[model samples]
Target: MIQAMYKRTKIGCEVLIQQAIDECPISTIKLYISRYYKKNNQRWALWARQHSPLLLQVTSTNSLESYHSELKRTTSSHYGLIGACHKVVALDQKQRTDSEYVAFEFRTKKISVMGLDDEILNEFHKFPYPIQRMLADEICAVENRIEKGKAIPGLTSLHCNCLFFIRYLLPCHHIFHEQIYGPTKLLTTNSWRNFQLMFEESGFEVYFHNELIEVDILEQTKAEKAAEN
Candidate 1:
């Protein structure tokens, strides 16, 4: 129950914690919940307002720490300054290439919704490609449930009861199920779309700036050589 609570947003956590307080049989568990969760709830719980869409899938900082470890590994006693610099550049390029490839695949590849019922799949198709992939994953994870409630009306007022949709602003399995009953527009304000937009807007500027700098440096070097001659 505690672990489940940790995965929920602050509002959801409060609801679950209250349920635990009212129904939990174990005295020690109730005591711990009352003391730690009830008294100092906001300090520990992940509030929806504070959460970032990019980090909704992230559980810990271990991945970042691992990347730092790998970066440190690129430099050692065996490597000179130039060798370390070259290795760093190579690693950076490889990472950038991998990122571009992934983005390209995301943009180009057709998402298969083979198992989904025709109605549901048709609604799913109305979304953008990135959203389709995300919804597909969510739909696969949905278990059997007697769905209750009406579909939300519009993008501005859209919401899903599930934590993923609440925290990340992506439609969850429940929302998709709701969509079957009544169609709702999928909003595209989440981090994934933002990243795609940002890249599309700024990707060329860096290369253009770099080429200009290189040309200026070459011109300066040539002028210095001519003066010496």
Candidate 2:
């Protein structure tokens, strides 16, 4: 339970730990939980797992360390400033290109597993590029959701307590099972555009330019008040 809690969100971790702590028959285990796990629990959040250009699917610094080592292996101290800069940029470019290639392959490939029919794949394919990209992660996790059984009004109700939805504010695999109800809007809206798709895909410096249009968004959404008319 303790080991599994590492992948769970902050609230999920707390709930699991509290249950185990209360039900534990061994005083030593309970003490261990309270003293160690509870004390430094903040560090265990899914914080580091959120994907970014620099970190690319990393759960920790291992990949970053490995990347740095690769950089050292590829370039030499004798290369001096100019040569080293060229090698470093080349390596960075290759890495980003490889990432893009893999993403493209996945997007084009027809997913065949987890009981997904060709028709369903077709439905997913009909969404625009950005919306499809937003759904990619959710689609990959559909099997896992099937294994766990689809969530029922999870956490606060509309969305699951999983890290993906919390981080992106789009439909997680759980709620996405009902995509027929329409979730593409969330992926395209200015409020979520900055996050729904992977950010900093082409560069390292990150910034959001979406906050300036809240008034426009409100006006665009005023149609929701149709009944008031």
Counted clashes in each candidate structure: 0, 0
lDDT for model 2, on a 0 to 1 scale? 0.57
Candidate 1 residues 1-229, lDDT tens each?
5553354566677777788788988999899989987777666555532344443444468956875687787777799989988988887887789878877665456678767876555545544466567778887755343344434333333465566664445567665554444455343335335423433544323223221112587889999999999
- Error at 210, model 1, angstroms: 32
Which pairs clash in the backbone of model 2?
A: none
- Residue 179, candidate 1: C-alpha displacement in angstroms: 3.3
TM-score winner: 1
RMSD of each: 15.6, 9.6
C-alpha lDDT (0 to 100) for residue 224 of candidate 2: 62
User: How does residue 128 of candidate 2 score in lDDT?
Assistant: 39
